[model samples]
Target: MSSPKQRHLLRLGLSCRKISAQVTNSATESIVAMASSTEQEFMPHYRSKLTTFPRPHRFWDANIASRVGEKLGFRLTDIGISDVEIEQPPLPTHHRKLIAPFLHSVKRAGISVYGSEKFESESQA
Candidate 1:
């Protein structure tokens, strides 16, 4: 579900498209250029995400965090969680067993651990 702001923006976009159709060539050109430039500024992020993972949900791993941080012009440490650290899932399967003990210790120490996948992207800001 989108926020009210997002819904408003979508409405504004629809209105803009209607207006653009009735606008002069120069006005249309300007609007098109502005939209293109905005897209270009955000292109690196979109491309990196597209090439790295099929969806944002894949960021459950530390590797994705590092890659995403690099693409977003930020440090992996800035996003929290070390690339070497892995979170154990709720059920300790074969793969989860590898990190289960470590996660249990971290939890017992009262340290909070989070994955990028569970949170919204910075772009939303």
Candidate 2:
């Protein structure tokens, strides 16, 4: 007979396996949706990137997977969306705006520069 903690660990591992299966299936569906009707399609390889990382839902670890799903334009599965809210990127508006001009200046000096005329046209468009 296993200890309570051991039993809990076993359950958690099983749950992770189930979640992986679901995500893999979902990925396969996504690939099918994107594939052309007559084209040979590649199999979906849904690697469980979150398994090794600490479970975000338990005791409120940050929801990295959830954020990733959001960025990828997918719904976070029940297992993916943890109780904890993900950490948000800081809005360094002043610093970002200051750096923006410098970055643009550097880009303008490069071979692939979007020159002043192109920039003005694009902005207008």
Candidate 3:
């Protein structure tokens, strides 16, 4: 929903993940971790290896829960869940690009700052 990058990444990643999702009376959080081509290339194969099992793979990462469905499907059963809690880092702010202006100010000057040892000064801590 954000941009075309999602489509490209998903195609290369080849997920059964839906392009659009709806949650009913539930709060949802999205977490995006850097996905290397190597990881993308192997995720499908790794997931395929565990399709027959109804529970999480023995080595399945707990942090990647948001993007994985089948690995956590066993929690849906009537057996009940234990020792799991939702963790969040507070809600996001409206001003999304907080550090961009600082970056722009630093690089806006025409002079190249890298290797400019002439301007460097030591400060005793």
Candidate 4:
């Protein structure tokens, strides 16, 4: 059974397949860029600004999704899990920059970096 959100998206003319194709094309472009560069070329050189850590759940869900997608060779959207929204506080800009390369690599590897700021913004819109 489709979730209400999924049905709503479908009703609005964005089918899952269309969404998947769009995401896949965007990911392919990034993957191609990544393929031409070494890891060090893409990673930012910055010191982490985090002085305190929050509870694990704050980051655990996205981390787990990335890892599982890596292992399974499928993004969350690949298996109709697109509507599972997770809300998280925005990360500091420095933190985002520090992890941007890692997240890019994850996406390049065919995993969805869920709960990212981009996703959050789009979901809210």
What TM-score would every model get versus the actual structure? 0.19, 0.17, 0.17, 0.26
Query: Per-model C-alpha lDDT, please?
Result: 0.26, 0.22, 0.25, 0.30
Query: Model 2, which residues run further than 4 Å from truth?
Result: 1-91, 111-125
- Give the best candidate by TM-score: 4
- What would the per-residue lDDT of candidate 4 be over residues 56-98, giving only the tens digit for each residue? 3222223333333233234433454333222234545433342
| Candidate number with greatest lDDT | 4
Tens digit of lDDT per residue, candidate 1, span 1-125?
A: 21222210000011211110111113222211101112344455545655664455321233222222233222222333232212223432322322233233333333233442322232133
From the highest TM-score down, the ranking of the candidates is 4, 1, 2, 3
Off by over 4 Å in 1: 1-10, 14-38, 57-125
Query: 39-92 in candidate 2: lDDT tens per residue?
Result: 121112123334536543322111322222232222222123211111123323
Instruction: Return the TM-score for candidate 1, rounded to 2 decimals.
Output: 0.19
Off by over 4 Å in 3: 1-42, 45-67, 75-79, 82-84, 91-125
Write down the worst ten-residue block by lDDT for model 4: 10-19
- Alpha-carbon runs more than 4 Å astray in model 4: 1-87, 114-125
Q: What's the CA RMSD for each of the models?
A: 17.9, 21.7, 19.6, 14.7
Q: Is candidate 3 or candidate 4 better by TM-score?
A: 4
Over 10-123, each residue of candidate 3 has an lDDT whose tens digit, in order, gives: 111222231111111122233222222124544664566457567442322222322332222222122222112221222223111221221122223221222212112211
